[model samples]
Target: MKKILMQLKDYYGEYLLLIALAIVIGLIVGVVDAYFGMILLKITEIRSLSPFLWIPFLPLVGLFIVFMYQKYGKTSSQGMGLIFEVGQGENKVIPFRLIPFIIGGTWLTHLFGGSAGREGVAVQIGATVAHTLGNKLNLMKFQTLLIVIGMAAGFAGLFQTPIAATFFALEVMIAGKFIYPALIPALVASFVASTTSHFLGLEKFQVYLAEPFDFSLFHFLLLAIVGIIFGVVGSLFAKSLSILKSKMAMWFKNPYRRVFIIACGLSVLLLLLYQGRYAGLGTNLITASFSGQHIYSYDFILKLIFTVCTLAVGFQGGEVTPLFSIGATLGVVLANILHLPVTLFAALGYAAVFGSATNTLLAPILIGCEVFGFEHFPSFFIVCAFAYFFNFNQSIYGKQQILK
Candidate 1:
C-alpha cells in the first residue's frame, strides 16, 4: 500500500503543472464563450422582427461564411478532426489563425440565424490555446495530456457540468474504455474552470423538478422505452448528418464552396418555415422543457434536421447543446403520451439521448447527477445505459473508432 501510495504521488505531481495550465486556459475559454453568447443574443435582437424577412437573403449569410473561409481559414477546416489528430500523435498544431476564423465564422453563422451550438467552437479555442502553450513551452507527452484536460475545462466552464465535462473530454474519442489516468487532472481542471466561470456570473442551465417520485416497475419500463426511442433518434440524427456531409463533399470538390452554398440554401428554407423559434442556439426549447409548455411534437425532428444541415454545411459548433434541446423536447412529448411528469421525462431524455448519441454511458449519468441531483442517479444510470447500448456504437463524430 505504501508503495502504491508513493507511485500515485509521483504520478500526481507529474500532472500538477498541466492541471494548473488547464485551469488558466479554461478561464479564458469561459470568458470567450460567455462573450460570444452575449454577442449572439444582441444579434438576435437586431433580426427579431421575423425570420420571414431574413429568409430571402439567408443564403447570403452562407456565401459570406464561405467567402471568409476561402479568404482566411483553409487550415482550420478540420476542427474536431484536428483535435483527434493531435491526440493520436500528429504534429499538426492548430495555428493561431484559426482562433479568429472560428470566432468570426461562428459569430456570423449565429448572427444570420444558423441553427448551431457554441461549445464546439469553445473547445477548439481551448485546444488551440493548449497546443500553442505546449509548443512554446517545449513540453512533451504530458503536455498533450494537458491539452485534453484543457478541453474538459472549456466544456465544463461553458456548460457548468464539471463532472460530465471531465468525462466528456476523455469519452468523446471512443466507446467502452475510460481514460482512467487522466480522470484526476480532468476533474481538477473542470471543477476549477466551472467554479471560476460561476464566479464570473456565468449561469448554469437550470431545471426545476418536483421531489423524487416513486419509481414503480411501470416507471422503469416507461423510462426504458424512452431510452430506446431516444437512442433511435440519436442514431438517426448522427447518420443523417454524416450522409449529408458526405454527399455535399462529393458534390463539391472544395469543402468551403460546398459549405457556403448549402448554408445559404438552408438559411433560406429556415426563413420560409420562419417560426422565429428554432434559430440560433435553441435555448428557448430548453426553457420550454422546464416550464412544461406545449412544444411541437416534431420539435426534436425539426431541430435534428436543421442542426444536421447547419453542421454538415460547415458551420462550426458542438452537437451536444442542440441534442439537449431536442432530447428535452422529445421527452416532454413522450411524457405527455405516457402520463408521466414532463419535467422528469425531459431531464431523463436530455441526458439519455446525449449519452446514446455520443456512445457515452457514464458521462451522461454524471451529467444527470450534476445537473439534476443525485436522487435521479438510479434512473439516470439505467436509462443512459440502455440508450448507450441501443445506439449500437453510432456517434456524431463519425471518425471515432471505438476500442471497447
Candidate 2:
C-alpha cells in the first residue's frame, strides 16, 4: 500500500500536466476545426449552386493548385505522410505552411466541384497547432503523445464522436497496436474537442434505427455477406487510389501538367455523369440513401470511381466522407437484396466500410454506436467484425504500419 501510494504521488504531477495540456489542445483545435468545417461546407454549397460554371475550370484550378505547391509548399505537400513519419519516430518536422496550403487547396478543390472530404484538413490543422505548441513548450519527451491527442481532438471536433475519435487516433497510425500510453490524454482531448465544436455550432451526422429485428442465424449469414461486400469495396477503393496516384505521377512527369490534364479529363467525365452527381463531398448520396429517395444501384460504384479519380489527380480532401457515402449507398442496395431494414444496414455500412478501408476495428464499431444508436450494436458488431477480418489488411493511409 505504501509503495502504490508513493508511485501515485510520483506520477500525479505528470498526469495533471498531461490532462491540462489535453484540455488546452482540445479547446484550440476544436475551434479551428469548427471554422475549417463550416467554411468547407460553405464552399460545397457555393459549388453546388453552379457546378457547371466552376467544374469546367477544374483543370485551370488544378494547375494553379499544383503551381502553388511546387512554388511554396516544398515538402509540405506530403501532408499526412509527414505526420505519420513524426509519429513513427522519424524525427521529421511538419512545415507550418501545411496548415494553410492544405486548407486553401482543399477549399479551391471543393469550390471548383472536386469530390473530396474535409477531415484531412481538420486533422492536419490540429496536428500542426499541437505540434507547434508542444515544440514551443519544449515538451519533447511526449511529442508522440501530443500528436495523438491532437489527432483525437481533430476527429472528435469534426464528427462529434469522441470515443470513436480516441480509438481512431490510438489505433490508426499503427494497425493492431493501440497507443496505450496516450489513451487517457487522447480521451480527454477528444471529449473536450467534441463539446467545444458542438457549442461552436458544428453539427454531427446521426441516424436512428426505428425498427428491431431478431438476430437469427439467417440474419447473421446475410450480415456476413454484406460485410464481405463492404470489405471488398473498401479494399478496392484503397487499392485503386494507391495505384492511380502512382500511375498519374508516372504518366505525367510534371506536377502542373499532370493535374491540368487529369483534371480536364475529370471535368468532362464529371459533367457527363449526371451533371456533377459525383462531384463535391457526396453528401447528396448519403442523404438520399437515408431519406427514402432515389438511390440507383450504381451510385456507390460511380462515387468510388470519381473519388479515386479526384484524389489521384491532385485534388485535396480526405477520403472518409466519400467512403461514408459509398458505404451507405451500397448498404441500401444490399438491404434491398437481403430484405433487411435499410437504415440499420446503411448505418452498419457507413461504419464498416470505413473500418475496412482504414484497416481498423474498434473505431468503426464505436462510431456505429455513436452515430447510430447503441441499440444497433449487435448488428454493427457482427458486420464490422467480418468486414475487418475480410479486408485483407488494406489501408487508405499508405504509411500506416501493420503490427502483427
**Most accurate candidate by TM-score:** 2
- lDDT of the candidates, in the order given: 0.77, 0.88
TM-score of 2: 0.97
Q: Going through the candidates in order, what is the number of backbone clashes in each?
A: 1, 0
TM-score of each: 0.91, 0.97
lDDT (Cα) of model 1: 0.77
Error of 1 at 251 (Å): 2.7
TM-score of candidate 1 on Cα atoms, chains taken together: 0.91
Candidate 2 structure quality by residue, lDDT tens digits, 219-295: 89988999989998988998898999999899988888888888888889888988888998888888888899988
lDDT of 1 by residue, 89-192 (tens): 66557777777787787777766778888777767776777777777777756655766776787778777898899888887765667666667777887887
Report the error of model 1 at residue 182, Å.
Answer: 1.9
Q: Where does candidate 2 stray beyond 4 Å?
A: 1-7
